[model samples]
Target: MIGQVVLNSNIMSVNLGLGVVLVVQDGVAKVSGLIGVRSGELVKFKKCGVDGIVIGLLKDSVSVTILGSDREVQQGELVERLYEVVKVPVGYELLGRVVDGIGNQADNKELPIELMEKALVEVKAPGVITRQPVREPLATGILALDSIVPVGRGQRQLIIGDRQTGKTVVALDTIINQRTNQRPVICVYVAIGQKRSTVSQIAARLKQEGAAPYTIIVAATASESAALQYLAPYTATAIAE
Candidate 1:
């Protein structure tokens, strides 16, 4: 009934309930049915099977690759997905262990279900789904701090030293390092001190590393409510997760 358009080649297709959509364009009519639909995308309104080929998905349309050449399609034809009205990631568990903001488990429990279909997938800690060996070095720039600190992939390492020991710098470096890895980790910097220069430096560094897309920053200083500061990291983590 409703799904995101994922592809449109000889056949138009979408991520249906648990499968892909297949719409035959040329076989029935040919008004440039498959003018859009490439990889890494979503489509809505239409539905079909995972393996079946369809004809068109003007919505969220990207030029589908054919035998040899590629072409452009009307982006307007594709529709962006509206957020769902589903309840929170409850009927779930999130305790003890540090978990992302979403209801997804951060501890060692296995998921009970599988997402066999593709719809409007949300940012669930972004890369928590992709596992890469935690071997690539993530530099901290500060010699003393760098030497003493270590963070594993998907780790929940907290910075608990005294004031002015460069905790922010440590966070900044990890954000920058993500640019060099094949599967980079996402960083959500939550600054409680309300330092302007520090946040500015972070923005500049993110541009340098080309990792801005994967990083999120939250700043709340002395005057703001303690409640806000306490909740900042969790909020950012939830969005990223």
Candidate 2:
């Protein structure tokens, strides 16, 4: 289904490039007639205000990953390049809250505090000269993990396993362990393609264990669009940094 395109008066003042949806395929839409759009730029479908991000530059069109309900978009619908990059909300106020990939509250409560600080979702890493060596240990408090595989403050560890495996358990334990650690590290748990109930349970567990004060949950449930799931990790990382 396609919604009627509505052009508000502010659109002209914003100098947004206008385009038309040429094709819609599996969470992606091909848009034509847009100019000056780079990969990762945010765009909005004029029809229903559904957000999308430019993922690829085609010969004559741009491939945009639709971030919201894709069912509201259709071929020939109007699109407007927002002329802005995707950003996520950042601040201490985000602690203990469940947010979506875009940093909007997912717990169904009205966020009374205004989130004034925002950061771009994508950033370039610092050069070697600006980097610092990892000297501190990030203890997970799990005897099995601490003895078998110790993780440091700046190390990257990948926990992989089949379905029903204890991958999430390992991550949750590490997060919960931070509650009593000497140097507490803020934790941001990103849930991608997970059931809503599973995300809720994790949040509840964190709160019950007294770790929610220093943790944030970014959830893109299984029911959400693929675009959101793709953005979840980056969003969580931005919040963590």
Candidate 3:
């Protein structure tokens, strides 16, 4: 079956099936008659002009989370399964730019060059045999941290504290310290549920400290839809990998 694809306001002719919106809820929507729908597939609501991703599959319906705005979607609207999953631009071109969860350029600056490489937002991890041990330390440049709680490469560490604590400051400092390190590392900072101003300040700080060129900021600010916030971390991790 043939389906119409609407991308960034442009309609492209492709062979895919279309589903009809059966229900709509807060950040969630249900579509019927999409037999080929797959998890993570991008779906566009024709009437509302919003994008969503398939999150669940029922016997007769597909559950989706609208990416940005979902208030305009209603029952009986046409939902086109783009057949392609959500992808993010991955190349040197994105190093210093701010992007949303789906890798759309958030900065107003025009891209200097076209991004030729795109990576799927969802990916599987490398097998155990392909991985190495974490013996090398990733210096944070903070004397207290380096001395007390040294982090190793490939190690996952969580920093938790009360509000107004220096959690963000520590992360920013670590990113900045990588500039002088002998080993090269690409950093991706995912900011979820943060205020827009707060994320902007963090991006500005990274640029000022010369870390922007080696870092990618994925932001899903507090004002954005819940779906974006939920996917921010996964998107950032995919970029880093």
Error of 3 at 137 (Å): 1.8
Candidate 3 on 105-210: residue-level lDDT in tens? 7788775435457788878888888888898999999999999999998988999999989999999999999999775478989999998899899999999988
| Range of the 10 consecutive residues with the lowest summed lDDT in candidate 2 | 1-10
In the range 83-173, model 2's lDDT, one tens digit per residue, is 7999988888888899998888899666644646889888886687777787877889899788888898877899999988989998999
Q: Candidate 1's C-alpha lDDT? A: 0.41
> Cα lDDT for residue 120, model 1?
28
Candidate 1, 1-241: lDDT as tens digits: 1233342422332332221222323212112233333342333322211111222345533222211111122222332222231111321122212222222332344643243221222244446557655664455445664577755554556777897896766677767766667866666665665755655666667767787666655555444434344445555455445
The estimated TM-scores of all candidates read 0.38, 0.87, 0.86
Instruction: Estimate every model's Cα lDDT from 0 to 1.
Output: 0.41, 0.84, 0.81
Q: What is the RMSD, in Å, between candidate 3 and the native fold over all Cα? A: 5.4
* Worst 10 contiguous positions by lDDT, candidate 3: 1-10
For residue 228, give model 2's deviation from the true position in Å. 1.1
Ranking by TM-score: 2, 3, 1
Q: What are the clashing pairs of model 3?
A: 3-16
Clash counts for all predictions: 25, 0, 1
Flag the better candidate by TM-score, 1 or 2: 2
